[model samples]
Target: MMNFRKAATAAGLVLGIVTGLVGPAAADVPAAIKERGKVLIAIDVSHPPYGMLDSQARETGSDVETAKLLAEDMGVALEIVPVSGANRVPSLLSRKVDMVIASFSITEERKKVIDYSRPYGVIPVVISAPQDMGIAAPADLAGQALAVARGTTADIELSRIVKESGVNARIVRYEDEATTNTAVATGQQKILAAALSTANEVSEQNPGLNLEVKLDMAAYPMAVGLRKGDDELKAWVDEWVGQNLENGKLNAIYEKYFHQPLPDVIPES
Candidate 1:
């Protein structure tokens, strides 16, 4: 088994071959890819500014721009496959999609099954409570009922912190952010949500909801994912990302959705 860095290096070489720029195989087309001159991309069309359906119901976003740039860099066309959050991984492994440009978080657990490009963005995990609730930090929520979406990284991270760090918060699982955000907004639970990006999205979309950000908890990274051992694809993506990061293209994309520039660097710690 090759490490991520090594696999990426090899993948870049293969990309060169496919583009007819280098390698002996450049003269002998790989039948698996020769007929299809497009990069199959899996995207969460519902996730905005990254991937989403427009008012006209057309698929477009910042990630779409990024994907087009990558395809250009790879010297290939792009075929985007709109997908939901739950189906992202299955689509990758089953070869239905060659890459995931969706807003996927990189985790130790997920890295085992799929390879990820270097992180492109950072999302802060916040512990949110109503203004009147008097909760200011992770510790302040101890012994109180708190809600989070089941099977999400936020729930797992909060649970780990509560158990290991000795926070007194009692965990409650909600089906989705809507219910959790509503519960918190209505003051049903002491703190109705523990999330990173989704909470921010909810708060911004609904003015009636007042969510105070508590950043004492952990922050996670966002990255693109590919099928395990697909070194060629991973290398192509890494080089494409590096180019964008250097040329101010990525900063512009970030600003379009976030109203800010991309950070100088993503904190590895």
Candidate 2:
């Protein structure tokens, strides 16, 4: 009899041969998840309202709760893989997590690497700074230091606006939302580009900083992110999101953390 590891290796080679003979195989992510009996979801606990630790130090937030509901509906155990804002994509691509639900917004750039479910929530990107800063527009940020989480929509959008507007502001990027927010709160950086909820959370934590939104950039719809070619999983996720949205459960969760209703418009994926 073959050892367990040897048997697994033999099985993999056989599967590879079969796959080669078939030319290609459609992703049966849904079935794979079912067989595993657990779904690994990535959530950014560093970003507030979307994901964070509660007073009890347990994980709790909109994204965390959403993942819990999804796992429950799918009849699978939920495994929360805590990730930083910059880690969502890498974690998915590396197969460390089955999907990401870290308030991840849909973008054409991201779509090239991964698929997304329909919009589940919306977040406003803003430039938060001291109340006295006269940064009413992107151009006004010239020569200022604006900190943002690397690889996030806030970072991408702000970089685009700065380049187009010919603003010379220094864009400082951090590995996570918490560090980005800390830069602003500690006065290491006077400005921050992040979700409105993120700015609000940082403000509440450091009231003396008096951070206020100087620029309300835009609201972006966030959705669950899956590895590319997960068509079956995407379909299931889309349907689940639609069902929850229609039943108002998604909105209830959104309102609980965001303090507002879910957005009415849906963007093209």
Candidate 3:
């Protein structure tokens, strides 16, 4: 698991207010990026329905499709740069990628490090446990062990829940979702796995490992990320997303992965 203490401290852990939708414009962005002939997009090649490597090793998912559409709207080529949960921000900061279309949550803390475009989806963070656990709520987590993805908002939300609720559940972090899911499924740790999206994917695959709980601990609004100070790029992506939503393209992407309509655009409150 990635170190949250250091990352949170470096980014400052403050509750964030939702932001209103901003119209996209082409006037303020860099000419190079606007006309570079290609948009370098960072995507997670391991997380399915968000960004993942298919059997053919091709990047496929809602995030990738949406990004490709955005690139087309800009009249640019789409270059998918594979990334992971921990490296999404670093990839953009280091210029390894121009923008991250991964399942990135837009938070006030993250805003300190990178700019987030309009929200694409709001995923409720929940717990996935084995069939015999009988765990069903945050309180049930007391004195239990839980598994979380290394650098996810699930980690942040779980930490906050434990601290605020005065629960004694030990949070055991893992390198990736596959590892966490495997551990939980096999009863290696008897730990509950936390997730933001694709709870059905985890449950469907692990029929033996039942999702015993559905705590709406937090609703994480996922968005695209850009390097700080890229207001022009932010606006462009934001506008593109809005147009897709209106055209029903965005909802199609959401249903393809989630088997449901996308959550409404939630402004920070």
Candidate 4:
């Protein structure tokens, strides 16, 4: 009677051996990937809990682990390529990566260029500000300086809201979320449009900032991104997403990193 951990390890070894012998199924993988015997997955290691480098400088996060599982399921070796929000899609389009498992929100604007699998997770874009800012809602953002990373969903949503509301808020764009968070935390910026997870990470890392979410702007579901017309890869990823969600494996990974139960927004299948 072996323990669960040992049994699972044994099962994984056997699975790996069987996968290596049988090879990747042609119906589930891109022809190039099946030829190469590996899949290149794009990930943004700057965003925590989603993708980041550990103390040993190895990629470790929900997305990284998920990509590993995806490659294993596809019976291929994994090759993670680091990418930023601005470059994740371009990397996939240029054939630099086979898929993007970063926190890529499924949106109509992106759909024009790339196809997305069913969402695996959800991230809430939030407006965070100091308690004294009096920025309780989107309308209150008028005349305030909002910080955001350019090309990100937060930037797009904040811009849209301001334009639709006819507000004259000042938007200050940064190269990345870390810099944007710094501007907001240090009082250089009055407000920040960022992911809820990012806001939490910023607050935890810099408690003196006293930042809090003033408004819930939008909730975006994240999905695997691939080049347009890749039906085989898309179908494989969709099936993987459905299987993981149903088995509680995805939830377990989410909870392990985020320290909370899987959000209700994650699709069941």
What does the lDDT read for residue 154 in candidate 1? 71
Instruction: Name the best candidate (by lDDT).
Output: 2
Residues 49-111, model 3: lDDT tens digits: 787777897888888888887776777788998877777888999998889988788777788
Best by TM-score: 2
Q: How would you encode candidate 1's per-residue C-alpha lDDT over 1-269 as one tens digit per residue? A: 56433444465567566675443223332234446887788886655556777789887887787777766655568898987655677788888987887767777877788899867766556676645667665667667887775544676678877888698668888754456656655667656454455566656765565666655467667778887776765655665654455556766777787777666556443
| lDDT on C-alpha atoms for all candidate structures | 0.66, 0.83, 0.71, 0.79
Greater-TM-score candidate between 3 and 4: 4
lDDT of 4: 0.79
In order of appearance, the predictions have TM-scores of 0.74, 0.87, 0.83, 0.85
Q: Identify the superior model by TM-score, candidate 2 or candidate 4.
A: 2
**Count of clashes, each model:** 5, 0, 3, 0
What is the per-residue lDDT of model 2 for residues 205-269, given as tens digits with 9 covering 90 to 100? Answer: 89998889898887787899999888878867766776677667888999898778775545544
Full ranking by TM-score: 2, 4, 3, 1
Candidate 4, 185: how far from true, in Å? 4.0
Q: Which residue pairs overlap in candidate 1's backbone?
A: 11-231, 11-232, 142-168, 142-169, 143-168
Candidate 1 accuracy as lDDT: 0.66
**Candidate 2, residue 166: lDDT:** 96
